[model samples]
Target: MPPLAIMPVLRFDPAAVAECISPLPPLEHTTLYENHNCSTSSTKVLYQIATHHYDNGVFEMKWGRVIIICAIVLSIQIASADTLNLTAGTYETFADNRTVQITANLTDSTGYPVNGTRVNFTTDLGNLSASYNYTNASGIATVNISSWDIGNATITAEAPTATNATVNMTFVVGPVSKIVLTSILEGTVNTTHLITATVYDKTAWEFANDENKWRIMPDVKLNFTITPPPGSTYNSANITPPSNTTNKSGITTAIVRLDKCAGTNGINVNVTNEDGVDVHESKTIIGVAGAPVNLSITANPYNVSANGIDTSQITGKVTDVFLNPIISTGSVRFNTSGNIITKPLDGTGEAAISIGPSIFTVNVTVNGTYLDEVGNSTNLTNETVVVFYTEEPARIVVTADATRISTTDIPGVNESAITAAVIDRWGHVLSNRSVNFSTTLGDLSSTTAITDANGQATTTLHSDITGDATVTASTLNDSGYEINGTIVIRIMNESFVSVITNIEPDPVEPGGIINVTTVISGQGNITGTRLAAHAMLALDRSGSMDPDYYAGTPLDVVLVLDRSGSMKFLGSGPEQPMTDAKTAAKVFMDNLVSNAQVGVVSFSSSSRIDTGLTLLHSSDNKTLVRGAIDGIYASGSTAIGDGLADANSMLVNGRGDARKITVLLTDGVCNAGSDRDCSNAIAIANANHITIYTIGLGSAEYIDEPLLQRIASETGGTYYNAPSSSELRAVYN
Candidate 1:
């Protein structure tokens, strides 16, 4: 500011304060002015001038020192002036805990930072917070709090910055809690549905002001609005999920529960989605009713052979069923015979089922089951089996069809009649049913047929029979057929050979011949001319009758009393012998003739020749008739033919069609007559087809089978040893 004045000082160093003072104008060049002024005028003038120069220089130096000191002071003041500032934010605390941190940073007002400045603490997080924090070298201040809650608290720092002097922030502490809602799926009436808008409030967004328009959005929520068929309602108390969970999946389940309310038929519901719209659909469940029934049966399979071709027999009775039978009137039809068969056989005399297909059905009645041969009656009202038949094999007398010993016919004889007589291995008849010959290549029928006694026909081939024919006999339907069966033979072929004559018994004719010459002659001879009869009359007569038993043993026999037995004694001619035993003898002969050939052996103790086996003959049926009448008187000791050999012999060899037989009639025993040779005679008679018919006169005890049989059986006849006169008549008949 004053260089001129300071120039004097400018030449100086501050270290020369002492030196400048030391050159003090000469302190007092002192009083020199005064002294000089007094001494001389010129001296006075020069003294004044020197004094002025000194005064000026001294003033200038002094002023320069003052300027330099002032400059130095101002530089010192600028070097040390700045302030601290602080900022605050974000503090956390427990729910209702109200504890958090408040911070304020320090810096100067012009934006220059200041460190180590003191700061005031804040509020806002819950209830508790620190009041102050020093601004570290970074100019930041922080505080830890104990509790904070209540909400809407403020944190301010007083003098946190050198210029602003204070800092503040507002905080709203909200409830820090998690809320959850759980729900089940719901179904809709149709396939799809829309959602209505949904709203939620979450603690995360508690800071969002409601006045700002939207509620705080939650972390998760089972919030959905599914639109069902219009006007859909829910069965569940709450259309929305109850509070427990917050997952979206839960929302689906909730919809299902609601839809179910529409009825188990299926249900639908509506809900509001954040953006409402009908979109997805829910599904319904399924259920069951009850168990099913199992029906079964055991039957002959479709393809096998059984009994007849009939269904009834083929599929036999269900003899046993675990269930109840079908009942009618009073009985149950529960059984079958299990056989099907053809009927009415031909010349074989014995009918068999196998001819056709034979099937039998067992009859089932209310009582129980039995064979048709057993309790077999029609079961329309009583459950009996009818053993019905179907169309039968047309009875055709197949006679040598083209004659190659038709295997299709009778195997051996080229002719076979369609007959039910054929039976199966099972003994079942080839049912009276139809014969179905159904092979690809076979003659099923004869264009021409002849009817017969048996509703059968004689089949005449159109041209000739050939190739193969498969036949099934069945009574069932066109469906059924008889499978297995067989055939048999004729019965008239069983007969015996020789015939016999003559006996030694007293009543018998002596010769071993019966005179049928006339009758035989009338019938004509086996030759154009034969003289054998003439020669017979003159033949050797040495052949006397052999003893019926031993030489003249009386024949043991019974005689007719005057009762019915006596009727035999009244006859004449061939029956004339009845006069002795009376008509009873003749009647006896008639009866004997029917069953056995009889040689008349009349005896009365000592027997005599009456009509011998020679006169009695089955061929000379007249002789046989005559011999029956020859009778003996019942008197004296009963004699028995030890053997009726000779008389028995007469009956044999005398038969044409009649059985050779010897009949001995006596009222007495063999006591008077030797019974010795009787047995022998019996032997002889037996070999000759001669038998004795004996009748006891009265008592049942009078006749012994051994004795009678000896004469009768040994001779191939049976004895009718009657007991009383009444029985005697019966025996004759």
Candidate 2:
């Protein structure tokens, strides 16, 4: 068999041939020619058979014919192998049952388009418009696909004529169903936090082993909205894309800013798709306090007495550089040069402490910390310090330069000099303190004198009456205690002349000078001079006079009281200046002489006649005056001049037969009304022949000493400076 050339015969199944050729055009009969050669040893002859088909039967086959037919069939199978290429118009769509177009291009292996080819289409998810499609004259086939369920879908196209001509595309189909947020759960105030929101679609489906299911959607346009918690805010610039829009992946990111006092803050994120499907997610963030940067300390009363028993309050406040108060439940420690006591801070970041009554200035220092709930402590960077001073006063002494004197029956003769020295308990002389001088049976040159640098105060006393006169010197110590000293002096009337009178011609004409002569007999000595007197008393009831500064006295007098607002400060315990003045006036009325008349006038910014001048001899009149005084209350401003004018009016209109006098007492300056000038008041007293006695109570700073002195001097009266209530009682006596 190897020696001889063997010919291979091509065989074909009739059913297969029929099926493959059914769509082809029918072949016509063709005759084959033979070629012959006659020469030499052999003659060769070749004959080509004609291919044909009869209506009824048998067919003839030739080797050359079989070869030609086989070649044609093989070429057609190769061209159909790569004729179709599939592509999707869009890879993503919503699961709302919307349709998408899928296309397949028909082409041969040489890249030449093959028309009239049948293409088959299908999807792993959803449905297609048709399972098969024929390529058009342009060699392209298209189908519409849709999905009712959410998921990813795979679309495939294949040419039925060619086994290797196939193409597939994946598409996403769904609506937004869920959202997720990712961020830090806690952060400091005024800080930034990275937040991310991921959008998902519950209707989206994924395919595995020909099965379809829901999955995350891709290539979807998502919109995001962020809602910050209370006391928190967001940064517009920190949002990606600036419009809070998600890309095809359905994700958005932003940075949020929290407030300074943020407590437990939560952030909410909402996401929606183009189809109007939405979802939400939330996250909680814890806010922390800032660091402390400064501390301030203060003392309410920076100074106290060195009696070693007083205390002061020390407070400290903690804050940041911005001066915002630090809210914490922490304690602060206090240090001092003397003694230290501690207290915790309140909600306002303030702490109070008690200090000691020491001799030296106390330097206080404060240092502390603020703690947060997370056990973080912030120390104060600045140190706070405060100082307190302690002061005290000790004792006083008095002396007299001359103790005795003698004078004739005159007004201003017998004079004695008195001196007072203020000495501290340590034997050191203290100056600038006031010493008041009073006499029981005489008049003093000056009622008040301040101690000089030498710690000495001097005054002169004079009396025309021959008797024993008592002089008192008093001052108030630093502790509000009274220090007093007194001395008695004998006044003897040593006049050398007795009563002897002569009249020129026993009588004289009007406006003519008459010669009068008096002779001294040296027989009788005059001891005292007596005169009837009428007096008015003016009193101040300013707020500072709220203390019980006076008691009642027995005298035929008009009580004028100041009822200014400052009188509220006048009194001790339950007795105010007005109340005390009323008590004193009532007592004076009780002790008045039977034939004496009493009245009452109370002045503030104005004056009123509470009780008119009435003889105390009548019990009914006394009751009426006392009741009026008791009804007086304190209000308004101090009107010294107005008060004096009113008192002068009462006395000038009263019983004319009585010698007139006025007493004025005030604890404050005249501060109300045009009459505060006081000159008019003095002139009125002088015109009425009323002797004015002025009493200044309290410190020199409060009383107008020069004005009081002028009023008393012009009226030929005395001025008394009562530095304290006890001294005032002595003045009344």
Candidate 3:
């Protein structure tokens, strides 16, 4: 017989089943042990317990047919684990008691629908309409969420029996937060600008479809309008999608064309949302003026000196065709014949420039570009400013190659070259100037000459007469002032005169008239006649001449000096009659011929021969005379007679063959000596045939002029009256 067949008995409860199934641990088999207790009459019951193994961790019971039915029921109650996907139908809503719908879909791992499962909905920001819900046959559960506060909220759908398996959704609730407009606000006049306005919902979400295309909310519309500034117009003809309706993404765009206008302008963009509630936003765009169309320049103090400090102001202004000032800051370029200066224009549109020193007169022209506001520049504009310079003559200098010239025997052979130099105040040469040349006693080669690069003008002077001639150079300055320079040239005749001497009856007897004659002759065709002769030099030597008077050559002569006490006070300083007499006597000696004889006599109350008549052929004789002259001093009374007598005695005793002459000089009348009267002395000189030259020194009251004149006349000699030491030298000469 076949083994006894048995079925397993299993029981299941649907209410006790978990929402999710957990994974089973690895196992080989399961075992069960049973203890049976039965009481029966006439028949014994037998029982067997067994272990079962299955691949799915389910135990197979072999008991009865009811176990199969129980197994099927338990399998149906233990549902498979599933995932829940939560989605927000609308991501945003108004916070004013508005609600957002959240939907949750439950599915198995393979994406099959899981039905009859309880799903719990929760939020971090708002309250859900239903905290718990069962998924429908389609495995979808939906709930409504609401919040009083304006903020973002997270919605979660979860299965209680599934570990960490949940679905999340994001939602926002509030009024319109902000609006953004995108565009380049700046554009040239008469140009168009593409402006876009993007509207953000209460959740700052771009409401769009899955294709990134905007989805308009129910009954929501946007109004795009642009308001231009005064004196400016806007054109909307280029705007696409003619209506001002927002696309699916709550974004709208418009093309705004600006009218021609200068200076700053504003374009306002305003957007209004008409979706059951009034929501609005605005944006501003700035417009700028066009490029410069016209430029003008002006200058102040057009004329300036060449000095480095002189400056001029050059101003320039830039504007558009509408004549509106550009408000931007820019630089103006300035150019001139001299230095170039560049400076930025101030708010008033002006610049200042200057130049350095100039050597000569010059006319400067200035040119430059005018820059307008906003860094726009116009074409070059130029203006001329006159800078005049005046030159003045600082000085005029005249020079002559030769100071002296001979008479023009041969036209231009005997001449002098005269040069005149004209210079500026700073000593710089002034060229191309006219200088006039004129002469007093000579003829010039040219009357006028122009200065060369070296500032010099020259002319030749021809001597006309035998005298000094003056050459004058004159020039005119810038101020019409005349400047002059002069030089002198001396002219002399070529001919000169000489003397021819003749002596008749040689060795004439004493006391006899000797015949001597001097013939005047011209060496070369002389034009004038003149004669001169030597004379006896009578000088007053007193204490007055000792104070180092003017120098003179020593001559060969006899000096009759007065040594009286009155002579000391007769003249000034060392120029008293006695001292001056000695100086004058020395001058006379220096003028004498070398072979001539000289003697010295000093008289006071008495007379003494300081030096005897001696030939001046040797230097020793001159030294002896000088020594004797220095020895005479003032100490005694005046004795004019003794002085004259002693002079005559010395002359008469000398060589007879030589010309005998006596110099009688005295400053006072006879006051001492027995022969106080000079008549005896004069008579003795006449007897010896001696020529006497008389000089009366001192004032008229001191010396006896009548006596001296008589003595000179009686001896055939001339008488000289020397009132001063200077006249004494002249008389001696």
Residue lDDT tens for model 1, 233-310: 532213334222323322223422223223232323333333343222233321111111111122222222334443
Alpha-carbon local distance difference test for all models: 0.33, 0.59, 0.61
lDDT of 1 at 14: 36
Model 3 weakest lDDT span, ten residues long: 64-73
Q: Which runs of model 2 end up more than 4 angstroms from their true locations?
A: 1-149, 152-174, 202-250, 257-287, 298-314, 324-331, 341-441, 444-733
Q: What CA RMSD would you report for each candidate?
A: 40.5, 26.6, 42.4
Report the alpha-carbon TM-score of model 1 versus the true structure: 0.23
The backbone clash count of each candidate, in order, is 188, 37, 29
lDDT by residue (508-574, candidate 3, tens digit) is 3222344565545453354443444432222211112221222223223457788888877766755
Regions of model 3 farther than 4 Å from truth = 1-144, 147-177, 205-243, 247-249, 259-265, 271-292, 300-310, 316-333, 338-365, 369-380, 384-733
In model 1, the Cα lDDT at residue 114 comes to 56
Ten contiguous residues minimizing lDDT sum, candidate 2: 71-80
Assess candidate 1 and give its lDDT. Answer: 0.33
User: Candidate 2's residue-wise lDDT over 630-656, tens digit each?
Assistant: 556677887888888878998988776
The C-alpha TM-scores of every prediction are 0.23, 0.30, 0.26
> What ranking of all candidate models by TM-score puts the best one first?
2, 3, 1
